[model samples]
Target chain A: MAVTDEAIEKIKGMIVSGALRPGDRLPKESELASELGLSRNSLREAVRALSLIRILDVRQGDGTYVTSLDPQLLLEAMSFVVDFHRDDTVLEFLAVRRILEPAATAMAASRISEQQIDALSAQLDKLGDSPSVEELVACDLDFHRGIVQSSGNSVLCSLLDGLSGPTTRARIWRGLTQEDAVSRTLHEHRAILAALRDRDGEAARSWATVHIASVEQWLRSTL
Target chain B: MAVTDEAIEKIKGMIVSGALRPGDRLPKESELASELGLSRNSLREAVRALSLIRILDVRQGDGTYVTSLDPQLLLEAMSFVVDFHRDDTVLEFLAVRRILEPAATAMAASRISEQQIDALSAQLDKLGDSPSVEELVACDLDFHRGIVQSSGNSVLCSLLDGLSGPTTRARIWRGLTQEDAVSRTLHEHRAILAALRDRDGEAARSWATVHIASVEQWLRSTL
Candidate 1:
C-alpha cells in the first residue's frame, strides 16, 4: 500500500510540475514504471487508483491520459464520500453549506441574468403553494443549484453540488415532519428569488443564510 | 466502465441506506458479488476503487470492511485531486479559501484555547525575524491550518487543508518574486493571532479575510 501510494504521488507530482499535462498521454507502461523507479505492478495499481477518481482516463484500446483536471471533474469524487457521512455529520455538512451557499448566492446576484431569474421563478411556480415532499425537495435543490451555478465558479459549484446529496435528504425529512414546512420553504424561496431579482447581493446572502439556518435549526432540535 | 460504476453505486447505496455500516465487514467476495447481481470481477474493481478513496479498508489477509467514514479519511482524496490543479485554477481554489477560511478562523477565535494560542504563537516565533522561503511557506501553512483546525469542524478542516496545497505553491512563487513577502506574511499572522488571543471572532474574521485577500490581489496582478 505504501509503494502504491508513493507511485500515486509520483504521478501526481508529474502533473503538478507540468511534466504530465492535462490530456497528456502517459508513457508506455513498462517504460514509465522504470522511469518512476517502480515495478510494473505498482504502476498498474497506481493508474487504476487514479482512474477511479476520474483523474486519469483509461481508454479501452488507446492509452491512458491525464484528465482535463477540471474542478468539476475532480470534485465529483466528493459526492461519493459525502454519501458515507453519518447522520450526525449531516449537521456539520449543513454548517458548511450555510457558509458557502449564501456566499455563492451573493456572487450569483451580481451576475445572474434576467433569463436565469425567470427560470428560477418558473421553477418556484412549478412547485405552486403546496407540493409533495419529493417535489419540494427537487424544486428546492433546483432553486439553490440554479443560483450557485450562476455564480460561475465551478469549484464552488462542485463543492456545493457534492454537499447537496445528503443535504437534499435532510430537506426532504424536514419537509415531511415539520409543520408549515411547505409554506415556509416556498416563502423562503420566494424571498431569495426576490433578492436575486433585485440584484441585491446582501439580501441574497442574508436570505440564503436564513434559509439554510432554519433547516439547521430544525436538524438540531430533531437530533 | 458502466458495470464497474454500477457496482460502485450499489455498494455506496448500501452504505448510505444503513444496510452496510462503518467498520462492518463485507460479505465474502462471491456472495457479495452475487447479492449485488455483479460479476466478481466488477465487484473487485469497485472495491479497489473505494479503497483508493479510503471509503473501504482492505486487509491483506482478512476481507474488506467499510471504513470509519470519518470526514478526514474521506476528504484526504481531495488533496490528491487538488494536486492536479493548474495555475489558473489556483485562483478559483483561493476564492473558495477566502470564504471558508475566514469563517473558520472566526469560529476558532471564539473557541480556541490559550494552549492552542500559545502553540500557534510558538509556531510563528519559530520562524524568527528571517526565514527561507521554504520555511516561511511551511509556517504559513501551519499558521492557517492551526486556526482552521481549532475551528473543530473536521469537514471544514479537510477542505481548507486540501486547498492549502496549491495555495502553498502560489505563496512560494510570491515570496520568491515579490518584496517584503516574509515580513508581510508574519505581520498578518501576528494580527490574526492577536485577534484570536482577544477572542474576537469578528476581528479574527476580518483580519483573516484581509490577509488572504492580499494574496489574492497579488495573484490577480501576477496572473
Candidate 2:
C-alpha cells in the first residue's frame, strides 16, 4: 500500500476497533505520526481524505475528531459521489429508487403521524396548480423526503436521497418538455397523499411505484 | 468554504459541467492551480480527497484523471463509510437491505438464466451440512450478491453490497450462537433458489423477505 493508504488504514483501524470512539479527539499530529510510524504529511493527507467522506471533522482551531458515524451522515458521502455519475446510468439509479421509495412510502403509511400527513397535504396545497418547473422539482423532493423520513429508517432515507441526484435532471427535463407532465405529477402526489391519509400502505406503495415508473418510462423512451 | 473544499468544488464543477470528462487527465498541477487561483497545497489536498472517493484516479508516475464515475465504483465508497458504523445502527442498515434485496431478488427471477441458477445451486451444495461460520457468511454474501447482480441494476447491487458490511458480523454472530440458524438459512436459500428456478418473482421476493426478516427478528431479540 502507499504511505498515505497505510496511514488511512491505521486510523480506520483505530476507529473500527473502538480505540478512537466517535467525537474522540485525535492525538497531536506529531504524536500520532510517530505512534503510527507514518510521516506527518501522509497522516495529514489521510485526515483530509477521511474528512471529505465525513468520517472525521477538522475544526479550524480544534483537534480532529471522529464524527457521529450515523448512517445519515456516512451515506451523505453517497450523494456527493452520485453527483458525479454519468447520464447513461440515470435509469439504473431510478430503478433502484423505484424499489426503495414505494417500500418507504408503505412503511410510512403504517407509522406516519396524522400531523405529518396533514403537513404533507398542506405542502402539496401550498403548490398551486401550474407551478414553475423549479418549484415542482423542489416540492417533489420535499414531498418524497417527508414521507420517506416517516419510514423511520435513516439508512433508507439517506440512500433514497443519495440516489435522487442523478435523476433530478431527468425530472426537470421531463417537466420542461413533456406537456401535461406537471399536472400528472400533481395528480399523483395528491393520490399518494390521499392513500397515506387513509393509511393504505398498498395503495400508497402502488402510487409511489407508478409515480417513479412514469418518469422511468419516459426517460427510457427518450434515451 | 475551506480552501480545500473550494478547490474540491471547483474540480467537481468541471466534471459536473462536462469540462473534465471521464478518463481526462487533469492539467499539470502548477498550471491548473494557477488557473483556479488555488495554492498547490489546496489543490493537492482536494485531489487526494477526490481520489479517496474513487472520483479521481491517481496513477503512479502518471497524471491524475477523472474516474469512469461508474455507479459501482462510486458507491464502493459507501462500503468504506459503512465500516465506521456503530453497532446500534446495524438494524437500520438491515431494514434497508430487507427492502432492497427482496426487490432485487424478484427482478432477478425474470432475468436470471439457467446457468446462473445452476451455479448458485452448486455453490450451496458445495457448502455441506456442516459448514463453518466463516463459510456460511461468505456463501450468504455470494448468494444474495449473485441474485442481485442478476437484477441488472448496478446501483441496487452496489447499494445492497455497501449496506451488507454492517450486518455481516450480526450474521456471523447469529450463526455461531443461535441454534438451527445455519440449517434454517440453508433451507431458506434452497427455497429462494427453487422459486427462482420456477421463475416465480413473487415467491422469490417472499422467500428473500422472510429470510432477511428472520435474521432481523433474531437480531432484534438479542439487541
Candidate 3:
C-alpha cells in the first residue's frame, strides 16, 4: 500500500479498535508521521482526507482532534457529493426526500413535544408573507429541520438537512417564486404543522406527501 | 479561505461548471498548485480529501483524475459511515432500505434486460444449500445490487446499495447461518425475481418486504 493510504488506514484502525475515541487529540503531525512510518507530507494527506469526512477537526494553530463522529457529522460529506449530482437527478433526489421526510415527520408526530411544536409553529411565523426568496428558503429549511430533529434520529435528520441543501433549493424556489409560490408554500407548511399539532401521523404523512409532491411536481415541470 | 479548501472548491467548481468531467485527469500537482496560487503541499491536501470520498481516482505513478461522478461511486463513502451506526439504528437503516430496495426492484422490472435476468438466475444457481457464508453473502449482495442498478437511476441505485453494504450483512449472516439460511436466502431471491418476471410491482414489493423483514427479524432477535 502507498504510505499515505497506509497512514489513513492506520488512523482508521485506531478509531475502529477503540484506541482513539471521538474528541481525542491526534498526535502532532511530525511525531505521528514517524510513528506511522510515513513522511510528514503523506501523513498530512491522510489527515486531510479524514477531515473532509468530518472525522477530524483541524483548527488553525490549535492541534487536530477527532470529531464527535456523529452520524450527522460523517454524513455531512454527502452534501458535497449531492452538490455535484447530475442536473437531471434533482427530482429523483427530491423523490427520495419525499419518501424519507414524510416517514420521518410521521415518526416525529408521536414524539414531538408540545413546546417543540410551538417552536416549529413560531418558525413559520418568523417568516413573512413577503420575504425575499433567500430568507424564505432559510426559514423553510430550519422549520422542517426542527421537526426532523424532533424525531430524534440524528442520522435521518442530518441526511434530510444535507439533502435539503441551499444550492438545490435556491434554484427550485427561484422558479417557484415566479409562480405565486410564496403563499402556496406557506399554506402547505401550515397544513403540515396542523397535522402534526393534532398528533396525527397519518394526517402528517398525507399532508407531507401532498406538500412534497407539490414542490416535486414544480421541480419536475421546470426540469 | 485556507489554500487547501480553496483548491477543493476550485476543483469541485471545475466539475460543476463543466471544465472537468468524469475520467478527466487533473493538472499535474505542481501545475495545479501554481495555477491556484497555492503550494504543492496544499493542492495535494485537496486531492487527498476528494479521493477519500471516491470523487477522485489517484493511482500510483498515474495522475489524479475526476471519478465517474456516478452516484454509486459517490455514496460508497456511506458504507464506512454504516460501520459506526448506533446498534438499534441499524434497524432504522433497514427500514429505509426496505422502502428503497423494493421501489428500486419495481423500477428495475421495467428496465431490466433479458440478459440481466438470465445472469441473475445464473448467479442464484451458484448459491446452493451448502454454500459457505462468504459465498452466500456475496451472492446476496450481487442479487440486490443487480436489481437496484437495473432501475437506471444512478443516484437511487447507488444510495440504496451503499445503505445495504456487505459488512452489515456479513455481520448478520454470520449469525443467521443457522436454520438453512443458505437455502432460505436463495429462495427469497427466486421469489423476488419471479415477481420481477411477472411484472407485478405490488408482488415484488411484497416479496421484498417479507424477504428483507425475515432478515430484519432474525437480526432483531440476535440483537
Judged by TM-score, which candidate is best? 2
Pairwise lDDT winner, candidates 2 and 3? 2
Candidate 1: stretches off by over 4 Å: A1-7, A25-45, A59-63, A166-171, A174-179, B1-3, B27-43, B61-63, B166-179
The docking quality of candidate 2, as DockQ, is 0.80
Per-model C-alpha lDDT, please?
A: 0.84, 0.87, 0.83
lDDT string for model 2 (B1-223, tens) is 8877888999999998899998999998888899889878778888889999999999978888999888888888888888888778888988988989999999999999999999999999999777676777788889988999999999899888988864555454654555488789889999999999999999999999999999899888877
**Model 1 chain B weakest lDDT span, ten residues long:** B170-179
Ranking by DockQ: 2, 1, 3
lDDT of 2 by residue, A7-50 (tens): 89989999989999988999988788889898787778888999
User: What's the CA error at residue A222 for candidate 3, in Å?
Assistant: 1.8
Q: In model 2 chain B, which range of ten residues has the least summed lDDT?
A: B166-175
RMSD of 1: 2.9
Residue-level lDDT of model 1, residues A13-122, one tens digit each, is 88878988889999888898998788876677678778888889988678889999899998987887787888778888888998899999999999999999998898
DockQ list for all candidates: 0.59, 0.80, 0.57
List candidate 2 segments past 4 Å from native.
A166-179, B166-179
* Model 2 TM-score, 2 decimals: 0.94
How high is the lDDT of residue A64 in model 3?
93
lDDT of 3 by residue, B1-223 (tens): 7889989999999988889998999888999999999999989899998998888998768898899887777888888767655556677678778767777887787888888888999988866658788887888888999988888777777778777777677777888767566577778899988888887877887888888888888788888
